[model samples]
Target: MPPDYPYGDKVSEPISAYAKRIGIKHETVRTQCDKGILPIIQRKKGTKREVNLYALYLRAKYKAEQFIRDFES
Candidate 1:
């Protein structure tokens, strides 16, 4: 079974899988990860990086809440 995160979804997942789950392009997710825009877990040198889904979800939720607050103001 996949690891569970407190917020939702798996604790971590491949960029491609994450992009697919969120209905975005794999390249977009890859670009963000490459640019350090998204949280990731790199086990070791030359290993595949896994997107930190929990962190991403929290970041997105915070941003959305901020947007809503700004809009309400």
Candidate 2:
């Protein structure tokens, strides 16, 4: 089962769907999940993978900070 996040009941979704939403390849998202770079929920003994939107938000924020740093340097 997926976790019950406090983000208004919208917890997570399959990596494929999230990839589509973010305009990225599914395999790229899957790789990120496998590498533990992105936050995920494993359902049924890791048979199912779900990505957390909040985690993605954090990632985006971090990326934005990096971009700004590169811009400054």
Candidate 3:
């Protein structure tokens, strides 16, 4: 985990919280989720949505690596 990761030890977090933690607008996160760009799961009985932090972290890592490889080439 990054030194500044908020919600310590949390595997999944609400979309709004995750957006705030990452310094982005919650609406943007919602939009991404609606578009299927970000992985998310809707709560079984509510309108609340949560994002899988581990999946997000892995996705970010993969994107970073891809960028690095492209830059190196």
List all candidate RMSDs to the true structure. 4.5, 6.0, 3.4
Worst lDDT 10-window in candidate 2:
1-10
Candidates, ranked, TM-score: 1, 3, 2
Candidate 1's residue-wise lDDT over 1-73, tens digit each?
2233354546799989989988999999999999999999989989999998778777877898999999999
The TM-score, computed over Cα atoms with residue i paired to residue i, of candidate 1 is: 0.65
Error of 3 at 48 (Å): 2.5
C-alpha RMSD of candidate 2: 6.0
Number of the top candidate by lDDT? 1
Model 3 TM-score?
0.64
Q: Candidate 1 regions off by >4 Å?
A: 1-9, 60-73
Error of 2 at 72 (Å): 16
Residue lDDT tens for model 3, 1-73: 7765544788788888889988999999999988989898776856788988777777887898999999999
Highest TM-score: give the candidate number.
1
- Which stretches of model 2 miss by more than 4 angstroms? 1-8, 57-73
List the candidates' TM-scores in order.
0.65, 0.61, 0.64
Q: Which residue pairs collide, candidate 2? A: none
